[model samples]
Target: MNKRLLWLLFSILFMAGCSVLSSTDPEFSRENYDSWYDKGEYQKALNHVNERLETYPEDALLWNEKGYILISMEQYNEALQPLEKAIELNAELDSAYNNKALAYNETGEYEQAIVAAQKAIDLSEEEPEQFINMGNALSFLERDEKALEYFNKALAIDANAPYAQYGKGVSLYFLGKYEEGIPYFENYLHSYPNDIDALWYLVYSYDTLGDYMETIPYLNQIIDNQKENPINTVDYKGLMLTYAGELEEATTIYDGIIEQYPNEAIGYYGKGVLQIQQGQTDNGLQSLEQAVALDNSLKETAYNDPLLSSVYNDELFKRIVE
Candidate 1:
């Protein structure tokens, strides 16, 4: 009776310790892969997967997972090998086909992406991602009508699928259906609010439609989200404000640009044009001279600009530009 009780106690303790043991030993647990991956420790996740593969090289799931890890690392070329290997090991591995399509898409091999995505779609049901992959590749190939069909298939599967909406938007945008594309981008932004590409699409659509004022707010949003200096975006906003007749606001933008980037020829060039338009010709001429000194090309631009026509005959302006 005592021996039986001890055996039961030992079994209970061993089962209890198993999870803790597996959490440490990468060789003993698959959960560690997800633990590292879920935390965005992609290199650690890759290392863990690679370490396990050294022993269980035939493991198809691990091979597929390794491919996914490489994709997450943006190592698209490296991802293809393991993804192919996974499919070789298990012909029915739908996930491997999907991942292979994604890697091919990033590498600019659109035909291969479409082929792999087709395979994934055939192997799985209700998977919008594969449809999106095919749509993206077809769109890249200038097969907009065909691509639209696939995007529509994805949308039919999930009406609110953001990626499908984005893909459809891209097709329509390229096809000159800017007005129709607007709703799809808007739908996509509903899910991915700050998506830079979608925001730029909206900007272009509004600009192309001659709705200049509509573009200003979106441009401002893009400028605000820029991680780098955003000097170009700031210039765009300043130009847009000028077009909107918000002269004071535009002047402030130019001043800010000059202060932030003192050596930038564009800031001085923009400031000089605004100054000329606002009848600050003397100050404008000086700024234009400085701009021409920094970038000789702006001399030709100043000569051609209608805003400086009033000062065209000015001796100082002729000395600065002509």
Candidate 2:
């Protein structure tokens, strides 16, 4: 009877060890969460976080990580809860306040974003990114002068900071110092050659300065880069085509984009601009009307675009405005 009991106890211990190996490995779960987040599967990442949190509820960094994923998913209100929870657990978690500021910015709570960003800056170990975040939040508040100060502060900390350079460029651009803005953008692009935001702003600054010829190289670079990542290519291509008087090519590109993404309003708006540039008034009006109907954001620029000047006096254009 004693021998039989000893064998049974050994078997039970073996089974318990296997069960522990299968379920409670923290490294495996952390890696799984990272993979999901990288693939933009935020909900899956959150589920993983939930499982992990069951075991490590006091982990402030994990809560901050979860908050960032929620912010990326644009679940701003939902993100605030986790971010606030993280801050409550650890007031020194700079990333938590930084992510919370982003969420607040997305929700149009500019003042809240400013406060959060300031808190993040105060808590941050690394000064440059924190200053950049504060500058961005201030920009959203239309405190351009204050924003410029923080951007300059960031640049003072690290002149090589691409984000700080970009922020300074934007602040200068909005302050009507286009010439001053151009060099900062160029400096940023020097370090981050594939930065689309820097490329786009360089084109805008060149256009504003009426150096349209200088704009061509950056625009071509953007188009070429799009072969690898096609997010902003259509806009860059359309601008170049418009300036080069290659309306037919521009129209083709815009049509192809619209076919692939019918709900995207920019393609329709671009097609309208190209049509109006070619003196096809009625078709251009129809495209612009469709664009404005699909997305009101396009309406803000409809009247100001030079390509649409031909149809500006039309009844349809008046109706669109009304």
- Number of the top lDDT candidate: 1
lDDT per prediction? Answer: 0.78, 0.72
Instruction: Write one digit per residue (lDDT tens) for candidate 2, span 97-185.
Output: 77776677667676887898788777663567666766766776668789899899988888887777878888888787889989998
Worst 10 residues of 2 by lDDT: 10-19
Cα lDDT of model 1 by residue, 101-123, tens digit: 78787778889989998988888
**Candidate 1: which stretches are off by over 4 Å?**
1-35, 51-56, 279-286, 299-322
Clash pairs detected, candidate 2 = none
Q: Clashes per prediction?
A: 0, 0
RMSD of each: 13.7, 15.7
